[model samples]
Target: DIDRKHIHIVSVRVDETGKKISDSFEKKRSDAIRKELEKKYSLLPAEKQRQPENLPLKRVDYKAGDVKKQVSNVAKVVMKSYRFQSLNEYRAVLSIYGVTVEEVKGEVRGKAYNGLVYSALDRKGEKVGNPFKASLIGKTAGYDALQKRIAFSKQSMKEKAVYNRSRNIISTLLANKPDRKVFEKELAKNGISVLFRENDDKRIYGVTFIDHQEKTVFNGSRLGKEFSANVFHELFNRNGRQDSSGIDYEKQFHINNQDYQPEQESTAEAIAGIFSMEQHGDDYEELAFTNRMKRRKKKRKGFGL
Candidate 1:
């Protein structure tokens, strides 16, 4: 219905008891996205256009308890700065900003819709207050916009080619049988944050890596199966004789050359067993024979023949 000066809109939600839900979802979502802009950008009532891209956005303070604005600021900065292909990957990065997002899909009054809900998290990783609809922020933070961003991020990550650097750092650490605390410390030193998602039984089910240097977030499996949660859990749980892939990370990727390498038998030894891991430290006689041969050569040279 239309009024003389303004139009009114109404909606409702009913609970299982057939009573109204009385949630103020619409009012909160309808709060203009321009509120943040006006407060920070000094926009006057006369300004019609949004801020330009060249202008920098003021970072929001998560401690201020402004969930909506905080979520919006984090989403904008992440969408512009980082490369993530999946919701989990995106959430891992947003989590650093004290925010999280969920994808929602359902039917209402015979209409089906898919959308995202944004929420703010506290220092302890608890939701602070009511969540906000994607619409409350803007199209930039909407579901569709994020899907496009994911695709573009995929391409951008490929072009950057920095994943290997992140991987080598992680693999080098894991290969040495480091504990969880040491693993995290080494990664942090290399500008990487690995978030492990675990369950009630303390079983690690998922993992995400955020590379601060490259500004990229990657799911564990996306990096490779070797970096998956299973690999990490096994490394910390089991004796760590071998990583999840059953390859000794230390020997396979021996970065420290001072570590001894097995002395080889004659070059004509069995070809099929070349990759064997056996090391022969009991060959004292062979070393003695080599020393004798060297001395014989020295004595021959001393003769000046």
Candidate 2:
């Protein structure tokens, strides 16, 4: 949230050609000044993202009705196209393709084994048919292969600063742009797409990033705690809210009331009465409302005197 009315002075340019203007190495000097200003103001740097070659432009289509084939295509493509750590992270990207995966753990011949099964999803995002075993699709999408892929991805990503670049871009977008749609659009320009999983209430429970430049799909929590889904939900859902995750609003309300002199005995009660309160999250507002109503009625008795 930024003030729409404020003039956020980013840069000032002067071009008085009459006196002090010089054309010698002007381009080089201007570039240096731009870098210095960006560093000083912590502004977003110049674009460095480049789309990779041989990447698939289309995603899986769920309406085609071939569950096994559709799941197979996206499963293999996602397994090769993205770099994800855990199985859950892998499945998050798959969801956008109308697919889901699960791990079946068991023992065979006194040895532990883990296997992957992919299922197709319907328009409602529910699994519609029998799940396809990893072997049925290919070994590349299997449990063992994915384990190796995860390790290889970690080693490769650790050697590059792509993670840092993503974090910087996402952080700046979130702070500067308040709207989620705009945030997503800006990210798209940087070769990144976000997948948010929300419950029926539309509160985001999980977040995944598909960075086309880096050819990686990973969960936001893997990037850092700050990029977690809860953080984004709190940010996008609230207004002028400093701390939504950990705040005892009831206690704060009591403290504020006790610290200030009451102009009207029923101040809290009158305010609560004007606004209908419902059961939300912790319902701290409900408690505050009831207490205010009680105090207001008590003060009315004093008016009778």
Candidate 3:
């Protein structure tokens, strides 16, 4: 406290080392860690920069204008074949069958008396011909005999009605087509058998006829390539041949190996099973055994066979 006014201090000095100890240690530690990482991972070294490979270029030559012109030409040709007339006036031909007539004899020489004639009616059941003339004829062959003959004739006519009607329909449909023979051939190819021809003077344009349980008619020309293609496709399909429908004839299943089997699988598997049985007898026997077991199980479960 007494020497406060004249207090003195001494400073201490240290010599500089080659590098700071802490800094040297940090540098060495960093290098050691880098070397350890390199030894453990062994990553690929950096490579020289390179240019990317060039890909081949392509060019389209189709011009929009040229495509439009070509499409227009095809459209014009197709349009020319289409009919534009009103369809309301289209007529079909139908045949009247089982038609029988009766005439009465006159008391005077060389003159036949006109009397009521009875004929079998159409599906509508309307009595055909004059009743009085029918009665006179009925008198000649008794009512029972006449009725029997009429019934037989009616049955025969009905049997032929489908065929007759189909012919009439086809003829009427082809009336304006101008390619009747071609159309007929096409229909025949499709299994349509023409029965009778219709009168041309009636100006009928379309006809309908019976094809077994089906009614088919030709009404107009095929609309386009697609329609023609479809017709041919159906024809070939039904005839067991390969048409342009992309169906492979060789791949289908069949009961007999000689028959056409399209490459498509059948839902019932009947054809495939039959074919397999024919080709692989042992496999077929095993399959049959399995099927029989399944049927027995189903029967036990109260399912209908």
Most TM-score-accurate candidate: 1
> Which is better, 1 or 3, measured by lDDT?
1
Q: What is the descending TM-score order? A: 1, 2, 3
TM-score of each: 0.57, 0.54, 0.16
Ranking by lDDT: 1, 2, 3
lDDT of 2 by residue, 1-305 (tens): 11123344344344655465566897799778878988999877644422332234223355555556667767776777678777756766666555778888899999998998888765345676687898988887799988988887778777547587778889888778465655655665565657665544655666778665566767787778989877887887776432222322122112122211112332222111111111123333235545765898989988983
Alpha-carbon runs more than 4 Å astray in model 1: 1-63, 158-160, 239-305
Model 3 lDDT vs. the true structure?
0.30
Report the lDDT tens digits of candidate 3 across residue range 171-281.
555454423334433343233422221122211122222231132222222222322323433443354543122322244222222211212332112111111001111
Task: Highest lDDT: give the candidate number.
Answer: 1
Stretches of candidate 2 exceeding 4 Å from the true structure: 1-57, 62-65, 197-205, 240-305
Better of 1 and 2 by TM-score: 1
Writing each residue's lDDT as its tens digit, candidate 1 over 174-276 gives 8888877566656654656677765445556567787766767886777788987778768777864322233222322111212111122211111011111
Which structure is stronger by TM-score: 1 or 3?
1
TM-score of 1: 0.57
